[model samples]
Target: MIRILLADDQRLVRAGIRGILDDEDDLHVVAEAADGRAAVAACRELRPTWC
Candidate 1:
C-alpha cells in the first residue's frame, strides 16, 4: 500500500481528496491534517511512505 498524508484547511477538500484516493486499491490515506503543523505531526506519527 502507498501510505499518504493529506493536509488541507478545508474539511471538504480533505474529504474529497480522501474519497478520490480511497478508490485506488494501491493507495491509502493514512492521515489527514488541517494545517501544516498537524500534517508534520501526522507524518512523524504515521511515518507514511510518501509524506
Candidate 2:
C-alpha cells in the first residue's frame, strides 16, 4: 500500500481529497495536517510515502 499524508489549510479541500483517495485500492491516507509545520511533524511520525 501507498501511505499518504495530506496537508491543507482548508477543511473541505482535505475532505474532498480524502474522499477521492479513499476509493482507491492501493492508496491510504495516514494523516492530515492543517499547516506545513504540522505536516512535517506528522510525516516524521507516520513515515508516509508522500506528504
Candidate 3:
C-alpha cells in the first residue's frame, strides 16, 4: 500500500482529493493538514510514502 498525507487550506478540496484517491486499491490517506506547518508535523508523525 502507498500511504499519503494530503495538505490543503480548503476543506472541500481536501475532501475531494481524498475521495478520488480513496477509490484506488493501492492508495491510502493516512493524514490531513490545513496548512504547511500542520502538514510538516503530520509528515514527521505519519511518515507517509507520499506527502
Candidate 4:
C-alpha cells in the first residue's frame, strides 16, 4: 500500500484530494496538514511507509 500525508492550505482542497486518493485500493491517506510546518510534523509523527 502507498501511504500518504496530504497537505494543503485549503481544507476543501485537502478533503477533495483525500476523497480522490481514497478511491484507489493501493493509495491510503494516513494524515492531513494545512501547512508546510504541520506537514513536516505529521511526517515525523506518522512516519508513513511511503515517505
TM-score per prediction, in order, is 0.94, 0.97, 0.97, 0.90
Local distance difference test scores for all models: 0.95, 0.96, 0.97, 0.91
For candidate 1, the lDDT comes to 0.95
lDDT string for model 2 (1-51, tens) is 999999999999999999999999999999999999999999999999976
Tens digits of per-residue lDDT for model 3 on 28-49? Answer: 9999999999999999999999
Query: Which segments of model 3 are wrong by more than 4 Å?
Result: none
Candidate ranking (lDDT, best to worst): 3, 2, 1, 4
TM-score of 4: 0.90
Compare the candidates by lDDT and give the number of the best one.
Answer: 3
lDDT computed for candidate 4? 0.91
- Tens digits of lDDT, candidate 4, 1-51: 888999889999999999999999998999999999999999999987655
Could you tell me which 10 consecutive residues in candidate 4 have the lowest summed lDDT?
A: 42-51
Better of 2 and 4 by lDDT: 2
> What is the number of backbone collisions in each predicted candidate, taken in the order shown?
0, 0, 0, 0
RMSD of model 1, in Å? 0.6
